[model samples]
Target chain A: MAYELYYWPTIQGRGEFVRLALEEAGADYIDVARESEGIAVMMRMMDHAEHPPLAPPFLKDGDTIIGQTAAILLYLGARHGLAPKDPAGGLWTHQIQLTIADLVAEAHDTHHPVGVGLYYEDQKAEALRRSDEFCENRIPKFLTWFDTILARNPAGDAHLVGRSLTYADLSLFQLVEGLSYAFPKATGRALKQAPRVAALHDAVARRPRIKAYCASPRRIPFNQEGIFRRYPELDR
Target chain B: MAYELYYWPTIQGRGEFVRLALEEAGADYIDVARESEGIAVMMRMMDHAEHPPLAPPFLKDGDTIIGQTAAILLYLGARHGLAPKDPAGGLWTHQIQLTIADLVAEAHDTHHPVGVGLYYEDQKAEALRRSDEFCENRIPKFLTWFDTILARNPAGDAHLVGRSLTYADLSLFQLVEGLSYAFPKATGRALKQAPRVAALHDAVARRPRIKAYCASPRRIPFNQEGIFRRYPELDR
Candidate 1:
């Protein structure tokens, strides 16, 4: 059976991480929300009393439902040989994935600083302050940390863990990609100080499969509705 | 070597989740920040790292440094037999853990609705609006979803997953505890509609290890600095 993925139809959001892994592995999967009846089916599945997902961006494999971006990616990675085979290596990969998840949450909060429910316009002042902190303090703090990891890696800076393509590397690429889209000025500034991380992001983007996915319609565009949003005031 | 846990010295915060799992499993570990030289050591460690963790509540196991609450729990759970051994069961446990992580993040945002660096007093107005949406919309939605999961459990609602204990159950207990601490009025209102969830929280609390931990000095009290804080105005 084809793996079924459920997420918001409009934005890449958290679902894109899972989509990237699936796409890279050449796995047979259905992007459920993209189909005509998919969103309703996804919502109905969520409404089920038995085995309801805690939220969207959930993956359905036969009868099993898994949510959480990192969890979904971990499952897909392990099932389709995208993660490290060694136990320690796999755990380290997960460790990196979870940290990326933290970065994603913080990135989302930059725009919705006042409240997730409030419009960005309503929270513009707070968002501006938050985004300033993110760009000046948090972004460099996080990116530099990843850069340090890459520098210290025994397997070289090509991949996040060991010497292979783990989901962590893929995620770092996506993270840099999203940050570049949402906060190009800030990202560009930080990228100057994070050479190893920048190199990895460039390398991941150049992968044939990933390059195709990025150019294809299956890969959604980044927008204000997504986690990483572009606000001129916030970026500045 | 004993596991070394690093976090802020005072509040339970995210470290409490890791502490709970370690305590429940009877694992040999040290809460580094709470010890005599702990905070200094944590700071030095952070400064010395080529790849410092993005933030606190990280764990050090010999040479490996792991961060992120759920990821730490996942590692410890798998290593010490706290999680389900089966592939499907383990994936489900992670799904629940990630959802709980989401709830924790939302709970934290209720008070710091504007910016993490600013004082709660600075963001009181925005927090009030955020708290209202959280209390009226998010809290019920999340709690009721857990209630549905409990009601739909094929093995019974005694535990969150199978009939046995899982890290997700412990996390749910902590979630309910934090919610109750941070928003007694709102949580009280929500719990009335989620009897099974309440019951599960109580049951987990009543476990010998957990009960003892709650009553002991090891269990840090929730404070304004922590993720969950008591602000009566926000609750109402």
Candidate 2:
């Protein structure tokens, strides 16, 4: 059976991580949320289910519907060659994915520091401080960690986990892209200190499938409506 | 080999989720950071490992080091039957755990809206607004989702997944306890609307091992330094 992915149609947001996995694997699937009555289908699924998904970006197999970006990646990873076959290696890869999720959440909070439901305008001042701290401290901390992970990978610095291009490497590639769009100056500054991470990002981008995905209309561009928004003043 | 748990000794922060899982399972483990030179050992491990952990609350099992609370719980749940045995069931349980992690991060941000490293006093105004949004919006949304998950559970409201307890249940118990201490008035008000979630908290509290662990000094008390902090003004 073909897989069905349900996520917001417009933004790359969390859904992009799952999309990257599906795209790179050359897997057969439909962006369910991008189909006709997609949004309604997504909402109804969220509202009515035995095992209800709390939010979107859920993947529906014949009888199973898996929610959570990282969980979806894990399920897909094992099915494909995206993750390790062994328990130890797989667990480590999953851990790295979880940390990437953390970094993503923090990046979103930089723009919506006061409340996600509230407008960024209402919390501009608060966001300024949040962004400043993120740019100065969090970005360096996270990128350096990624750089270390890359440097320490005995197989090579090309992947975040083992020698293979796991879901983590794909997610990290997206992360660097999102950060560069949202806070270019800060991310650029951090990237200088994380040469290995930068190299991995570039290498992931050069992969045939990912490179095609990026060049295709299938890959959504970063915008103000997405989690990683660009507000010039806050970026400073 | 015994599991070696490493985290900051002072606060029942993110590590509490891992701690609760181990304590409930009656797993043989050492809270390494609670021992002497524990902090140094943790830092050195973070700096020296082939796959260095980004932060603490990492678990060491024989030769492997597992970071991320949800990842650790996933590993333990599979090996110990603390989670469902089936792939679908396990994935759903993991999805719930990730949502709980999201809730925990939001709860922490209520008091640290500007930055994690910044003091509450330094961002008092921003925190007040953040707390208001959390207490009024995020808390209700999350608890309502939890309540829905329980109400939909075919087995019963006794557990978050399947018939038996999962790590998600234990984490939910901790979330309730943390929110209650951090925002007593708001949490009490919200709990009235989420009886199943509230009831789960009470049920988990009565479990023999959890009860003993709660009474034991191993369970660190919530403090200003922890994720769930008590700031009377912010709570209001």
Candidate 3:
């Protein structure tokens, strides 16, 4: 049976990370919420599944339901050879992915600094302050960390772990994409400072599957509603 | 060989989750940063370790170093039988852990709503708004999810994953501890609404090893400096 992926239908949010993994693995799956009446199905699953996911971006594989993007990737990565087979290498890859998730959360908070309950307009002042620190400190810091890891990878600078294309690499590509879209000026400068990370992003984009996926309708475009919104004022 | 646990020496923060697992398992481990000159070693390790952790609360067992609180527990949980032997059961435990980590991150952000670079006083206005939403919505939503999962567990309601104690149970206990410390009024009210979750917290506290560890100095007291802080103004 094809795997069922439940996430918000409109934007490349956290679900995009899982989508990249599934697409890269060439795994058979359905983006459940994007289909007609699928949002209802997704909500019902969240409400009544034997194992409920606190939020979307969950995967249902047969009787098993896996939530949390990193946990979902951890499940898919091992099964799809997208992570190292060895115990230590797999954990390291997972650690990197968790760090990426942290950065993504921080990015989301740039706009919703006061609370997610309020609109962007209601929290604009706080967002400005939060985004400044994010652009000045968090982005550079996270990018530098990714660059350091890429440069220090014993196998090669091209991959995050074991000279293989792990899900960390895919997620990093998505991170860079979202950051650049959200904060073009800041991320552009950070990318220049972290050339290896920039190169890795380009390399992942060149992957036949990822490249095709980006062009296809299946890949949602960046928007104001998603985690990485391109609010020009906040970007600056 | 004794395991080396690296984290901020003064605060329970994220490291407490790992410490709880280690203590409950009766594992011999060194709290590296709490020792004299240990913080220097911890910083240097982060600066130069092959698998560099973006931040602390990393564990080193001989040559293997694992970072990310949830990832560290994933490693320790399996070896200590704090998690199930089955792959599906293990992933379920990890999924719950990842969700708990998400709540922990949100709890930290309530005080640092503007940015971590700024002190809580500097972000007091934003913190108040954020904390209001956190107490009024996020906490209840998260606690209800935990309560629902506990109620729905097929094996029993006592454990988060299976019949036996898993790291998720321990982490959930720690989460309740932090929230209660940070927002006594709100958390107390929320706990009353989540009786199963409340009972689990009390049960974990009374466990022989965990009970002793809490009494021991090895368990740091919750203070204003940690992720969960008690600011009466912000709490209300």
Question: Per-model C-alpha lDDT, please?
Answer: 0.87, 0.92, 0.95
TM-score rank, highest first?
A: 3, 2, 1
**Best-performing candidate as measured by DockQ:** 3
Q: What CA root-mean-square deviation does each model show from the true structure?
A: 1.7, 1.0, 0.7
Per-residue lDDT tens digits of candidate 2, residues B1-236? 89999999999999999999999899999999899999999999999998788998899999899999999999999988799998889999999999999999999999898998888899999999999999998888899999999999999987889889999999999999999999999999889999999999999999999999999999898898999999988776
lDDT string for model 1 (B38-148, tens) is 999999888776446667889999987777888888888888877889988888888888888988998998887656777988878778877888998889989998888
Cα error, candidate 1, residue B156 (Å):
0.3
**True-vs-predicted CA distance for residue B90, candidate 2, Å:** 0.8
The list of candidate 1 runs beyond 4 A from truth reads: B49-51
DockQ score of each predicted structure, in the order shown: 0.65, 0.87, 0.89
User: In model 1, which residue pairs have backbone atoms overlapping below 3 Å?
Assistant: none
lDDT of 1: 0.87
Model 3 complex DockQ against the native: 0.89
Model 2 misplaced stretches (Cα beyond 4 Å): none
Docking quality level of the chain pair in candidate 1: medium
Candidate 2, residue B227: how far the Cα is off, in Å: 0.6
